[model samples]
Target: MKRSFGLAFALFVCTFTFAQQALWGGTSIVSPEIHENNTVTFRLKAPKAVKVQVTGDFLPTQKIKTPFGDFDGPGAADLIEKDGTWEYTTPQPLKPELYSYTFLVDGLKMNDPNNVYMIRDVVSVTNVFIIGGGRADLYKVNKVPHGTVSRVWYNSPTLGMDRRLTVYTPAGYETSGKNYPVFYLLHGMGGDEEAWIALGRTAQILDNLIAQGKAKPMIVVMTNGNASQEAAPGESSLGFVSPNMQLPKTMEGSFEMAFPDVVKFIDKNYRTIKRKQARAIAGLSMGGFHSMHISKQFPDMFNYVGLFSAAIMPDNNVKSPVYADLEGKLKAQFAQNPALYWIAIGKTDFLYKANEDFRKLMDDKGYKYMYYETDEGHIWKNWRIYLTEFSPLLFK
Candidate 1:
C-alpha cells in the first residue's frame, strides 16, 4: 500500500506538468463540458508590483471608463491586488473570443504573468481568451488571394545614407505582368518600416478588402521615416521607439527627400504605372503627418492623400525656421491641386481636435478633402479599421 501511494503521487506530478505544457501548445484552457460562465474573471500574479491597470480596445471608449460598473460588484471599479495577485471580474459574462491586453506596473509595460494564451511573431506576448467570443469573421485570415511583402534597400540623398523600405504587392500583379497603382504608406515617430505590416497587418487587410471588393488592388510601399541611420535611436536591436533623438527640424525634407528616390527606383525596377492618379499616399500618426506634408508638397506626384489620426497643423512649440517652412509647402499644394485629401480620426484620439482644426483650415482654403470620425482612439485597432476603409477607395 505504501509503494502504491508513492507511485500514484509521482504520476500526479508528471500529469500536472504535462498539462501545463499542453495549455501553451494550443490546448484549450476552459473545459467545453463545463458551460462557460458569462462572468469571466482575470487574476494576475505580480507580487513585486504596486499598481496594475488593464487596457484593451473593446468598445467605444466612452463606455470603457465605467466598464466594470456595467458588469458587477461596483461600477467602473479599479482592479485590486489580493494575495499578491491582481484580479478583476467582469460584471457580465464574456463571449468566446481572444482579446489583447497589457499590464501597467508603475507606468511601465509588462506582460501578464498569469495568462497562458500567447501568440508570437517577432515577440512572444500574452493574450486573453473568451471562447466563442470574437469578431472572427473580420479579423481572420482567409483562403483568398494573398499579398507579398519584400524588404528593399535604397540610398537617401538628404540623410546621406542607405535605408530600407518594405513594399507589398497584391496577388495577380506577378502573374498578370501589368503595372498597378501604388500607395506609399509611412510610419510615425519611433516606428519603422515593419510597423505597418507587422502591427497593422497591411497585407492581410488589403487582401481581405480587395477580395470583398471594398478596396482596389494596388501596391503599398512602407518606408522608414527617420532620416538618421540610428533609426529608432535608443530602442533594441530590432529598433522600436524609445527615449533619445530629438524631432528632426526638417522632418518634411528628411522623409520627403526619400520619396522621389524610392519612386524612381520602383519605376526602374517594377512594372509601375507612372501617372499621378495611379499613385496615392497615406499614413497614421507620424505617418499621417508625412501624408499631409508629402502629399501637399508633391501634389503633381500623387492623386490621393490620406491622414489617419495625424498632426496636420504644426505644433505651436515648433519655432525652427525649418519647421516653419512646412506652411509654405502646404500653401503650395493648396494653390496647385487638393483633390482626394482624406482625413480620419478616432473620437477619443488625442489628435481629434488637431484633425478637426486642420479640416477647418482646409475648408477655409477650399481644399477638396474627406473627414471621418470613428468609434476608436489612437491605437492599432482603429488604424486597422482605417486601412480597411481607406484602401478600397484608392486608385478609383
Candidate 2:
C-alpha cells in the first residue's frame, strides 16, 4: 500500500510539470522553447496552414521567400508542416533586443496566439523576441532598480514659449545629497524626449551601466530637437521633417534664443552641479546637428560636446559668412573651456561618411574631438551601444 501511494504521488508531480504552460496576463499560452544560443523555436498546431510566414520589421519587410536555414549560427527561420502542425524559425540570429513580429497566414497578419509576450502596435499585436548579444543588452527590460523619468514643463523665455523636456535621474538620487553632473542628451528626427525614454532605453541602460561600474552616475536631460513651435509633437502640418541641415528651417521658434533659458530652469529645479565642466551636450542625427549648433552657439554653456553619427557638414546657409564660420566658432567654443568632444558612428550607417567629414572639419579647424565607429547602422541598436560607450566618460 505504501509503495502504491508513492507511485501515485510521483505520477501527480509529473502530470503537473507536463501540464504547465507560459502564462500571458494570467492565461497560459505557447512558451517558446529557446535553444542554448538564445534562438527561439516553437511549433504552431495549425495543421491546415496553407502557407505560414514569420514577419519582422527588424529585417527589411520584404517577405522571406524561402525556408529559413543556417544563414548564421542558430539563426534562420523555417516553415515546415508535419503531422498537422506548422513550425517556423528565424532566418538569421536576431539582434540583442526585443523584436516585434507577426506570422503571415495567407496575406493575413496575425500574432502567435500561443506566445505570452506581446504589445499592441495600433489595432494589431506583434510577438516580441529578445536576441542575444552584449551590445544590445539595453533593449531587454529587466527588473533592476530603475531611475526616475519625469516630464518637465517650463516657461521657455528663450524660445518665447512653454517648452517641455524629459529628465532621467539615476538610482540613489533621492537620498544622495551629493549633486551630480548633467548630461544633456538629445534625440534625432521623428523623436522627442520620449525617444530616449523608449527606444534609447536611456534610464535602463544607465541603470545597468552604473550598477555594473561601467558608467558614471549622472543625470540625463532629453529635449525636443525641433526649434519651431509648430514642430512640438503634433503641431506641424508636415509630420516629421527628415531634412539634413536645413536645421533652422525647423528652428522657427527661436530655439537658439530659448535654449539658455531652459538651462536656467534646469539649474533651478534640479540639484545639478551647475558648472561648465559638469555640463555636457550630445545627440544623434538631427539631434547631433543641434548639439553642434547649440554647443557652438553657447560656447560657455557646456564643457563637453558629443556627436553620435552627427550630420554636420557646414550647410550652404550656415556657411562661413552667415552664422559665424565653423572655424572661428569652434575656436571660441573650445578656446575658453573646451569640453571633451566625442563622436561615434556605425560602419554601415548612412551618416558614417557625414561623421567622418565632420571630424575632418573639426580637425581642420584645430578642434579636439574623439571618433568611434561600430559595425551596425543608423538604428536603435547602434544608438543604444553608443550611449553605453559615451556615458561613462562624461563628468569624469
Candidate 3:
C-alpha cells in the first residue's frame, strides 16, 4: 500500500510539471492579423507580464479641453490576457492606410516582436500594417517598374561639411541613356533626408505614377534641411539626438545660401536637363518655407515650385539677412514667368492663417500662383496627398 501511494504521488508531480510547461510554450504568434472586413487583431505573448495594452494611429485620439487649450488625450486599449497571451481587436474597421502601432507591456513601450515590418520617423519607431485598398494601394509595393533610391554624400562648402542626401533615379534611368529632369524635394522641420523615402512612401508613389504615365520620369533629390547637421542620425559622428533638442543659431542659418552647392553637385554628377524649365522644387512645412526662400533667392534655377502647408513667417518678423529684401526677391522670382507655382494646405491646419496671410501678400504683389485646399489639419496624410497631386504637374 505504501509503494502504491508513493507511485501515485510521482505520477501527479509529472502531470503538473507538463501542464505548467505547456502554458509557456505554443505555436508562433501572428500579430496584426488583417481580416477581410478590414478589422485588425493584435496579439502578444507575454505570459509573465502583469498588464498589456496597445496604442496606434488607427485608434481615435481623446481630446482634452484644459484651461490652457485643447490637446490630445491618451487613448490606449487594455488587451485581454489569457493563457500567457494578450490580444485585442479593433471595435471598428480601420480605414485604408498604413497604420503604425506599439505595445505597452507593464508600462514599457515596445514594438511588436512578431511583426517584422516597422517604420522609423524622426522621433519614434513603431510597427506598421496596411488595410483595405483604394488610395492605400498607391502606397503599397505593386508589380511595376521601380526606381532606385540611394543615400549619397556630397561636398557642402557653404555648410563646411560633407553632407548626405537621398537621391531617386527612375526606372530605365541607366539603360535609357536619356537626361531626365530633376526635382529637389525637401523634408519638414524634424525630418531628415530619409523622411520622404520611409514615411512618405515616395518611391512607390513615383513608380506607380510613372508607370501609369501620369507623371514624367524624373530624378528626385531629397536634401537634409537641417543646416547644422552634417548627415542624418546614425550616419554621422555627431550621434543621434532628440528631434526636440535646442538648435544652434547656425541651425537656422540661410539654407538659400547653401542650396546652390546642392544644385551644383547634382548637375555635375547626374544626367540632368541643366535648365530652369526642367528643374522643380517642393517641400512640406519648414521645407515649404525653404522652397519659398530658395526659389526666391535663385529665381532662374527652378521653374516649378510647390509649397505643402508652408510655415510662412512674414518678412517683417524674420531677422535674417536672407529676408532683408524679400519684396524685391519675390518680384524677381515672379518676373521669371515660372511654369507652375503651387501652394496647398489643409483648412484646419494651425498654419492656415499664416498661409492666408502669405496668399494675401502674393495677391497684393500681383504674383501668380495656384492654391489647393484639403479637408484635414497639418499631418502626413495631407502631405502625401499633396505629393501625389503635385508630382504629376511637374515637367509637363
Candidate 4:
C-alpha cells in the first residue's frame, strides 16, 4: 500500500509539472510575437473569461484627470476570440522601440501568460517586448563586447549612511591595465541605483556604442539619489517597502555636500582617471537638478555636465547652499572651461519653460553650452535619447 501511494504521488507531481496548460488557468499560447515587419501579435488562451482586452503604449493613449496630475491612460482593445484563443494584432507596424502590455481578463489586469520579459517601474509591473532596428536596438542586447555591472556598497559621510551603487565597467577594464574616464549617471525622482540599468538600458547602450567606437569605454556609476533610502526596495535591510514619490532631503544640499564622498569612493576603488578632465556628471529630472548643482558647487570636479529635462530651481521655502549663489557658481563653473555642458529638453516637457529661463541665464552670462531640443514631454523615452546622444560627446 505504501509503494502504491508513493507511485500515485509521483504521478500527481509529474502531471502538475508537465502540463499543456499555463500555470495560470489557460492553454499556453505564444504572445508578443514580433514579425519582420515590426508588427506584433498578442494572444491569450482564456476561454473561460467573458472579455479580454489589450492595453499597451503602442495603442493610442489619452490624458486622464487624476488627483495628483494628468496621467497617460492608454486605451484598451478587446481581443477577438477564435476557438479557445483570444488574439489581437497591431493595426500598423510598431516603431522600433520597447513596448509594454498586459491582458485585461474580464477587467482584471494581468501579464501575458506566454511572455516572461517584464519590468517594474517603482511599483507597477508590466510585460515588455522590443522591436529592434533603430534606436530600440541600442536598448537591446547585441553581440558586442559587454561591460561588467556591480552592485557596490560605499559609505557616505555626508548623508551618514552606507549607500549602494550600480557600477558598469567597460568590456576589457579588468585586464586592460589602463585607467579610464568615469561618467556619473543619476536617475530621476522615485528612481534608485537600478533605474538606468533597467529602464535606460545603460549597459547595452554602452557596450554597443563602445563597440562601434561612438562612445569612449568608461565606467558608468549609477547612484541612489534618494538620500533617505539605503538602497532600492527590498534591496537593503529595510526589507520590502512600498515606493512613494514623497521623499525628503532631496536637493537639500546634503547630497551635494556629500557628493565628494561618492567620487572619493569610486576613485579609491575603481581604475578611474582621477582628475577633473576625465570626470563627467549627468542626470534626468531630479537627478538633473542634482547634477547641475553638484557640478557647479564643485566646479573643478567634472568636465562634462548634462541636464536632461532638469528642474532648474527648487521651491522658494527650501534653503540650502547647493541652491544659493546661482550666478556666481555659473560664472565660476564656466570660468574653469569644462569640456561639455549639455542641456537638453523636450518641446512638450513641463520643465521646458524652466529650461528656457535657465538658457536665458546662460546666455545672459555668456555661459557656453550645447543645447538639444527634442520632441515629447518629460518621460523616460526622452531621457534615454539624451543619454545616447550625450555619452558620445564625453571624454573627447
Structural similarity to truth (TM-score) of each candidate: 0.72, 0.74, 0.86, 0.92
Error of 1 at 103 (Å): 3.3
> For candidate 4, lDDT tens digit of each residue in 1-396?
999999999999888877634455454467988888888899998879899999987888666665434545567888999887999989899988777788899999999868878987777778989888888889888899899999999999878889999999999999999999999999887889998999889999999999999999999999998888899988999898888666787767777788899999999999999999999999999999999999999998999999998988888998987899899998999999999999999887778888999999899888899999997676677888999999999999
lDDT of each: 0.67, 0.69, 0.86, 0.89
C-alpha RMSD between model 4 and the true structure: 3.1
Question: Model 1, poorest ten-residue lDDT window?
Answer: 67-76
Stretches off by above 4 angstroms in model 1 are: 1-53, 59-89, 92-99, 104-109, 113-136, 230-252, 315-339
For candidate 1, the lDDT comes to 0.67
What is the per-residue lDDT of model 3 for residues 56-144, given as tens digits with 9 covering 90 to 100?
77876665564422434336898999999999999998889888889999999999988889988777788988784877877889999
RMSD of each: 7.0, 8.3, 6.6, 3.1
TM match of model 3 to true structure:
0.86
Residue range 287-349, candidate 1, lDDT tens digits = 898777777667688888899888665556644333456557677776766457788888767
Candidate 2 lDDT over 1-396, as tens digits, reads 999999999999887666663222334334355566666665666677787766664555222222311111111244677886677655465556656667766666677777857754213456766675676675555666677888888776656666678899988899998788899998876566667776677888888888777777888998876665433444345665443323344333245455787788889988999988899998887678778878888888998888887767544544332245667887788787675888888776666766777778778867777888887566565677788888888877
Q: Candidate 4, 81: how far from true, in Å?
A: 3.0
